[model samples]
Target: MPELIGIARLAAESPSLLGKKRVEYMSLTTRSYLTRCNNPRMPFRWMINPYRGCEFGCKYCYARYTHEFMELRDADAFEKKIFVKSFGPRRFLGELRKLPVGESIAIGTATDPYQPAEALYGVTRAMWEQFARTAGFRIGLVTKSNLVTRDAGVIASASRRHAVTIVVTITTLARDLAGALEPLAPRPELRLRAIRTLARAGIRVSVNLAPVLPLINDSEASLDAVAKAAAEAGAVSLGANVVYLKDCAKSIFFPFLEAQFPALAGRYQERFRNNAFLRGAYPEMIRERVGRIRRKYGLDSSREAAEPELWPRDPQLTLFS
Candidate 1:
């Protein structure tokens, strides 16, 4: 177990609250709700994660190491112990005002904001209500849950004045494979239904076929099926990225592969042994595959960032421009 300090230590000291199946919800104090991202590779500069640990428990989740910061060494603790950030709408709105206008904000960068806990605790929905008051902001939300559709009204209200995009992440349409990969997340078919609901509400929707596993869900037929579904559901764009095996993720994922997919386990070990990312030919092939799928479905890889007419002009934002 790594040494725990600061916020992680505080959260560890906090008493556990509700227990559900394998996961336990723990409440923690949050001084701030938004974080500024300095990663140049990412499109968004600001991000908000309503929860610290995700309940989805995906095999390839790269965020398991986040538990290490909390002194929870057991890799499984990342999924078994969930922490809900103490939400303050007033404080969150203040933090939002600090962001420079035109900068993008991504919700659920580290955890699914609309995860199962959301049904018991409506934090994600509350945040959207706060967003409804702001204008001239760019917001992006990604989720694997159909629960997002429950807040479609708030999302539509926010979109009236801001550039909002809701991305539904669907790895594969195969029920058994999806069941094994994202055990607790909503089914692929349910996510598609949510996409259609949001699109009909006039909210920009997209489908993300991310963490495209090599031997599992990366087949041409599989990718085409997801792309076609997104298009038929009225998605405006499509995007995908191959799997990345970070150190924390590999610790759990490697064993999972051995048990579930013995045939491909050895290949995965060799491919990820020397590198966290697959480079050279494999990535190039995936990019070409994704591009072809997008074109086939008439989906754009990029979205226009123009400000909507309803956005309230802000003189302070001009300073950052």
Candidate 2:
């Protein structure tokens, strides 16, 4: 077994030193795997996750439960123990072909497809290429990294055949807050630039100001600023939702909240004590605020129709019936 060393020692002798020393790290490896989530609320039935865990280390990540399923005990280790699916694109394409041709597919539903490691793995690029040949299907990609810019050409080609929407998620405009919340993801301005690039190429681009944590990012001015930026970036639509902590997410999110915005932590604890989902009132307020901002900026709402019922069903077989 490899022994753990303190960050100070590593920084003193290693060439990778930067700023101050903190946080011990580890590494691991794995093979191909797939996660099938039965999402009733989302607009798609199936999700293609090319990577197992995320490097972004977003404090409010809901996918932490996935680590438990893998029998991984440490939360910090989850972010670093990223598993790449070498043959994921081939297997995923094969599975996609087995289903109806027009079935909607959502990518990165469980983890960010363009996470930093993607620059090294290139699995997501292959998946996009495979889907580029198909027609009449709907594909939605949600991510925070600007790396998607590298595949703008492929995405544009795919859009010519089927529906393609790219949603770039940005929570807070403040650089410091963003750094604290999403340590490993691309900065907000870079993601905004990517949005502009994709929109310029005529690919539908939207902004998802999702999981808007109370006290941390629930201010009216903050919401409006994000909407304005989205509109300026030529986004076709804008959506916003309040944060809701579930299971392992609480462990990771609360500490940050306590350290950064101590005044708001008590309110969050009281409001989300028993419920995993945010209170009905919170969503209503968020919807109203987001709707007002959308109208103000002349941006469309990003909400879409419910997932097709016969999602895993064949459309051709029913065509003649």
| Model 1 Cα shift for residue 12 (angstroms) | 1.4
Question: Which residue runs of candidate 1 sit more than 4 Å off their true CA positions?
Answer: 1-4, 303-306, 317-321
- Clash statistics: count for each candidate: 0, 0
lDDT of 2 by residue, 1-321 (tens): 344344323322333211213322222222323334576777786677777678888999988877665556576655866655555456655665665556567888778999876787677888778777555567788999999999999998877766788989999888888999999889999989999999999888889998788767878899888888888988878877677788688888778778888888888777778887876787888889888988999988853423333332446642110
Report the C-alpha lDDT of model 1 over 1-321, residue by residue, as the tens digit: 666679878887777879977999998788788888999999988889888889999989988888887788788888888888888988888777776666688999989999988988888999998888777788899999999999999999988878999989999999889999999999999999999999999999989999999978999999999999989998989989999999889998999999999999999999999899999998899999999999999998975345767765666652111
lDDT of each: 0.88, 0.74
Ten residues in sequence with the least summed lDDT for candidate 1: 312-321
Structure candidate 1, residue pairs in collision: none
